[model samples]
Target: MSLSRTAMLLALVLSGAQAGQTVVAIRGEDFLINGKPTLEGRTWRKHDVEGLLPNSRMVQGIFDDLNPETARQWAYPDTGTWDAERNTREFVAAMKAWREHGLLAFTLNLQGGSPQGYSKNQPWHNSAFDESGVLREAYLVRLKAILDEADRLGMAVILGYFYFGQDEHLKDEAAVIHATDAATDWIVKRGYRHVLVEINNECDVRYDHAILKPERVHELIDRVKRRSAEAGVPLLASTSYGGGSLPGPKVVKAADFLLLHGNGVKGPEAIRSMVERTRKMEGYRGQPIVFNEDDHFDFEMENNHFTAATAAGASWGYFDFRMKDEGFAEGFQSVPVDWSISSERKKGFFRLLAEMSGEGK
Candidate 1:
């Protein structure tokens, strides 16, 4: 019980609880991984360190306005060569840094950001995903290249297809409407099997971010699944919405797994409440639990929450952007990060969970 956060997180990564382990059905009470009655706390990281928001609504809410300030803060400036090679290289390096902590990287592609002419807005309009000006082939080739690197590294990439329209352009949930067949074709055509597409970002229910009506989101998945089936691939659609339980507004059957976005919830309070609430829901009683995105230093909560969730029968997904002294990885620089652990140490909290599961014994 006496261990640092870094040590604990690594334990989770090395816990021998992989994605495709055994038949421990996503439902029921207390699951087991790889035939062993071990807890499944899947520690991982995301590649948003360079300013792209993968699965968090904070970035979407901030960037939805198309404000220059948030743009610059996210590092999606109009600078850098207006091509995918440079873009891919930048992300590849970042992803490599994350894997060093024994975590998986999730990539994002915002529709707003692009290089010079590629972007519609002048100056800062350019973003990491401004493909309007870049050669279509160049963009596809480079994108696939980044995905290949991710696939090679055994990491997951949450292809950011769109963001909330908080900025001037204001695409938000409505952007999906403009997502033409060509774009959908591109998502399915030019990528490896590892590619997973998230149709929407942190879409709020209280405030409509042009959200794809739940039925539409559901339809989108069906369409994508059909296309993915033709290519022998499984397509994934996700959203970062508020959490209450399977009974809440976010309880839609569009995605393959259960996902939730977290704020800076104090300790395991929100997590515990979220789980209990989920258990009370009809379909989510024993579903796969994914903390798709959240703020850092929640290591204590992560450590404690993951244990609580699996015991109640579920799986957890951890994410980070940078490996800075891993109590939890930091995505944006402005968010002060604690260097209590090494930049590359991710086993701080989960490390204990791993020991409990008898991993590395």
Candidate 2:
């Protein structure tokens, strides 16, 4: 029996080496499984870059490409606003469906906020907690529910706790820490074990969004890492961004793994340019890297980007929100989802991606 066990173990080790797979796979980006580094051939998916942007109307307006000046002219559905329960059910179903296609949804926060304009997503308050405390409370309650379901489904939810671009979602030092701690606790309890803890979606501040002092980002990363550890989940700290706070130490210095939001930068070449710059950097060289957001609109685009990111020694994923049946790549304006299919675009993109990366197969 001992001989058998030894031989079996030796065979396993030999096969792993023969196949070119590393010994310990990256839980997220520690050591990717697919002969890739950081987050090779993996796409950090998020359908709506502005999922937590603001309100339905504004979201629709943008989808319609309505100019801010004429934003009011564009009327959203009479069935306005995303209700928590309904959104949860819908998201849960969407993720299940996406699994069939090999794709997964981001966290509910990607869609977190309110009609007053999703928590902190409101333009008027950018980062102020309401004196009434209504929005924030409602948000946490709903968010808690969403995380619960995601865990049940074993879905990978990327919690964007920092200031992406929704200035309204901005938090002062105290609030930021409080919120981060809260989110970590909630996710842990629910068992959603986040695939990644992405701080500040895609923060792009205009004025030296650069804080000479970057203690806050570092602090946020450490707290979440600790909280996630307590929950028994292998936590990976990352920041998703493209501009504004470009080169901010928040990303340059503070994350466990590195991520880039090359939203409009399609094709392998464009992505390569950015990947090269980062991999060659001082802090980025050895750490893992991922492309959490590349909304080029469909599986084909995801394939293009994932291939590029991986070749560059990074992992990547395409974004997918809405009911899986809604359609792929945000569903062009004219071909909007009927909201009934519940899993249309889910099939192609994820399946193709998983297959290409050798996961689906």
| Winner by lDDT | 2
Clashes (N, CA, C under 3 Å) per candidate: 38, 30
- Model 2 lDDT vs. the true structure? 0.43
Per-residue lDDT tens digits for candidate 2, residues 237-285, read 6655552123445466667766676566846788878877776665554
Candidate 2 error regions (>4 Å): 1-82, 104-137, 164-171, 189-192, 206-216, 226-234, 243-252, 297-303, 320-348, 357-361
Which 10-residue window of candidate 2 scores lowest in summed lDDT?
50-59
RMSD of each: 11.8, 13.6
Cα lDDT for residue 261, model 2? 66
Q: Given candidate 1, what's the lDDT at residue 204?
A: 45
Model 1 is weakest, by summed lDDT over 10 consecutive residues, at 47-56
Model 2 residue 159 distance off true place after TM-score fit, in angstroms: 0.8
lDDT of 2 at 247: 43
RMSD of 1: 11.8
